[model samples]
Target: MRSGTAPPVPSAPARRLLLTAAEWAVLVAEWPGALPPGLSVEVPGSRQRNDAVAALVARGVLRAPVGGPVEPVPAVAADLAVLRRPLLTVRLETGGRGGRRHGWFALGADVVVVVLTLPDGGIELSLAPAAGLGAELARVVPEAAAVTGPTARGGAPPTGALPLGLLDAAPAGRGGPPPTAAEAALAGELLRRTAGSLDCLVLGRAGGPVGAGQVSWLATDGGWVGLRPHPGGSPRRVVDVVSVRPADLGTWVAPTVAALLEGRA
Candidate 1:
């Protein structure tokens, strides 16, 4: 990796990348904006560096959705029909090895969501709002979904959305008790900090043994934030936060978390 280097976005498992200032320059030098799906642009670099670039292409194509920030949900199979927005919903007439994966990347102020069904016998639902995410999202988006967006100041290894199901997966009478007033205030602050240009938010488990508490993600105008709910379900514990970027919206969260660890957040 040198002054000019841009990694490819993986396709098999949907992934997004936040290009470095230098990397962005390299990417724009060749191809600017989203390339056609399955298309690859040669990033400028040495053979070794270029090999890394090809590896990225093999893995996938990284770019923002042409449309805008959008969310994904099971089209027909999903019971939450309300969450379904008007996106270029493509239903693959095939299935995979029971593969169910989903991800999102940022483009400008807009975010794009991707859903895949691997092996060949499932529906791959990818939804992105033509007008990008709207204020109405507050009606359906969980307060925790924003934390998982493109928050890492640098970028995380594009991972799956927070498995929100984990929140309900806890044993009966769980969720600790009700949240206290202070706890509620903290949660509110976290939300307030990252609510302006929010695109998507998913509440899932943190990296830990099973039964770990829930962590909600926010893709906001200022940036991204990852926080876990108080055991009592009040103010969320901040896990990470990252400023937004251009190449991919959701690739900045890792650095945000690092900042928190470094006592900078």
Candidate 2:
């Protein structure tokens, strides 16, 4: 039941847009296409609507080339949609509450990938069946990586701050880099073996409630998988721990993740 704050205001030259509810609805619905003829006009009847669209265009959230159709910027559209309707909000600190929400989005109901925003203006993603997130979306931020941590058990208290090893050590932010072929292959196989129930585990202090307060685990009935982001790049390395007893997860998962993070595995 946590609420979200207002959309962030951009720095100078990108003023905050005061979009009417009708205008916002239309913009969200008609993205990637030209506005309806009526709303595109600047006549008195439509001046306000047209002005809102123009402001978005000026901010580069929408594009209108000399003769091209006005369209929503793909990356901006993705970001805006997530901001408006986040599936989950995670707080990296154990007792954290209220401010500085880290949003999470399940790309699509059937899609296994989840995207999370980092507080340092970076982004991280998780792939249940490791795969490619298109280059356009990947480049939305300067720093991006795939992260895996401890899953939130049904009733267990939250544990672990969002790990900072990758972010702390990552070099200056740059264009998001796509995952490596090897990383994708490993993820694919891990998901296939786990019957597509795999998810990257995140160990964070607190998170907003999801439906029924249920959270997924990194381990599935088939086995367990641990993934770590490559500290030096966007690609990730994974370890598969199969046929292990549930009671042994404690003994095996953490050590496996540690080795993966240290590049010893």
Best prediction by lDDT: 2
Model 1 segments more than 4 A misplaced: 1-175, 196-216, 228-265
Query: Which pairs in model 2 have colliding backbones?
Result: 93-205, 94-205, 149-201
- Tell me the tens digit of each residue's lDDT in model 2 across 1-265: 8688978864222112334443454454544233221122222236666776787688676788788877777755554554344332212111011112232322222222333334443334343311222221222212101121222222221222122222222553523454355544544444333321222222211233222221222332233333333244422222322233223323323333233323311
Model 1 C-alpha RMSD to native: 20.2
TM-score of 2: 0.23
Clashes of each: 43, 3
Lowest-lDDT window of 10 residues in candidate 2? 90-99
What lDDT is obtained when candidate 1 is compared to the true structure?
0.31
**After superposition, candidate 2 runs with Cα above 4 Å error:** 1-23, 31-45, 80-265
Candidate number achieving the greatest TM-score relative to the actual structure: 2
